[model samples]
Target: KTTTAALIEITTTTATTTKTTTTTTITTTTTTTTATTTTTTTTTTTTTTSTSTTKAPIFNVNMLNNGDAETGPCETDSNVMNPPGWTCNGEITQLAYNNTFIYSRVNTIPGTAPGGCLFYGQISGYTSMWQTIDLTNYADPSLIDTGTVEFNLSAWLGGFINQNDRAGVSVTFLNQANQTTGSVTNIGPVTDTDRGSVTSFLFRQATGFVPVGARSATVLVYIIRAAGNVNDGYVDNVNIFMYQ
Candidate 1:
């Protein structure tokens, strides 16, 4: 009967949770932080250099034509003494150095000429010859006008033994009109005393600055016979050169 009394008994249930908060604190703080960096590069360059040079002009050539007296017909007689490049006055003869009529000995001339012949004044009186050179063909007009050009005039002059007979060479600078512009430059008249009274040639030269406004030149060769049937005044190796 007690059991049947009634099952009206109520049961109370309590649920307790011991949260083992392992606090894994995995704090998955997914803090997504991203850093960006930029880099720059620099470069250098090199270069090669070069140099240039210029050459100067040469001015050592002789400007006078037939300066050696080897061109054209040459003869031993005064009547046939017509040199190609010159104008003659008195008997201007081209004779071989070994002419038996005048030189008794072979090659009377101490020095040898290019053509074995040399200029000789064959007359008893004064004999003269000349040649005109056009500077326009050999040098710049400005150089002459500015007085910057220089000249070298040279010749071999000789005379007979103990005689006053002598040979000479000279230059006369002229303007375009052929008028004289400067004093004469001479290099000869080799006196008997200068040649030691011997029959031999002597080298003579004259150098000077060209006169201003000079455009042409006249080369004069002369012989003065003092005492001999044959002038015996010899000339050879005439030369003229221009330089800066």
Candidate 2:
């Protein structure tokens, strides 16, 4: 059976009522049914979603921009700005297909995030990258209960062997005026791989949640070198997953 009707979309006002009606026909039968109007009292909610095929299992959407830093190639020193979602202070690092930087996730990881590249901090210095997301639309400034969001921010960090070489990501909560909301350093200070006082190429993950009453948030990725910058660490797969 085929049913035909003009499509009508309506967004009802709060403390309002919505009613819908339907008519069915089989040429031999006719039936008309009217749906009872639904009265909705005061209610408020905000939902934001971004699509992706490869995502962490916990969330149905990902809000990070070019979250894996593979939006394009991080070639040559002059073109470090290739990672689309962030303003970076570090170098863009890439993986050559000559058989290296390979792991289980690199083979099985999903989406637009390519597995062969990362961000790298310079040796003998500090490197930082940042991105911000506005949550003001999702929050009610006067109500703390309505102004909160929960999410996990993550980044994959690695570097050539050494004890002082370290990389980590931090998330800071901000108020609507771009002011700090008394929350910073969601997760951080992740160190590098070391063996008998010598640092080697290795990577790991660091992640944490954003605090409540945050009208916005800023994410930062940083690398620190205890010694020289040779074989300095690399970062990739930076991501954030909102609570479902």
Candidate 3:
């Protein structure tokens, strides 16, 4: 009967379990770095200059002072003989020619002679007067050194009637040491024969190149007595000129 008693029906059920796995992935990161450089430049500059000077050459000028003999204490018979521009030796005087004793003695002064006065030799024998002109005053040293200067020496030289007494002029170029640099240049000692035995003057002139190294020039007026007690060497309008 009932002994079936509760053989209870034990129903054993087996369940299958499904497992889900969560995987965490860690990724390693690697980084690479680089560097760069820059450069600069500069520049500079400069300048310079120079200067010089030059002089002009001289032309057409008379280098002698008082060449006309007009500045004088003019007299026929003067004791203190002083012609304004010359250093004199022996007896020398200035004679008034326009209306004085000299005009009567000379008979005629040249028309070219300046009307004021004349140079006279008052004593017998050798008589001389001179003047030194500084050439640098008229021309540049380069002009004189290179012989670019031309000289014109001129005078009216004369003597008394039929006498051997005579007058002459000369120019001597000198160095800085006062030594002669070249041959002397002379104008005239117009003789009584050349003057036709008349008491009058005759014109004379000379032209030439200036000597080298000539810093100064000396003008000499001289007289020689041949037949008279008084020196009859007469000169008028003596001149020295320079030109390029």
Pick the lDDT winner. 3
Q: TM-score of predicted model 3?
A: 0.74
- Better model by TM-score: candidate 2 vs candidate 3: 3
Writing each residue's lDDT as its tens digit, candidate 1 over 106-218 gives 26558645567788888749888898888877776765777888899998988888887899999999998889998999998999999898888899999998899998899
TM-score of each: 0.72, 0.55, 0.74
TM-score of candidate 1 against the unseen true structure: 0.72
Candidate 2 residue pairs that clash: 123-229, 124-229, 160-200, 160-201, 161-199, 161-200, 161-201, 162-199, 162-200
Worst 10 residues of 1 by lDDT: 51-60
Least lDDT summed over 10 consecutive residues: which range in candidate 3? 50-59
In every candidate, how many clashes are there?
0, 9, 0
RMSD of each: 10.2, 35.5, 8.3
- Count residue pairs with overlapping backbones in model 2: 9
Residue 12 deviation, candidate 2, in Å? 99
What's the CA RMSD of model 2 in angstroms?
A: 35.5
- After superposing candidate 1, which stretches have Cα over 4 Å from the reference? 1-58, 77-79, 112-114
User: lDDT score, residue 96, model 1?
Assistant: 66
Candidate 2's displacement at residue 51, Å, is 28
Residue pairs that clash (backbone atoms under 3 angstroms), model 1 = none
Error of 2 at 114 (Å): 6.4
lDDT values, one for every candidate: 0.79, 0.55, 0.80
Once all C-alphas are superposed, what RMSD does model 1 give against the true structure?
10.2
Candidate 3, superposed: residue stretches over 4 Å from native:
1-57, 78-80, 98-103
C-alpha positional error of residue 24 in candidate 3 after TM-score superposition, expressed in Å? 31
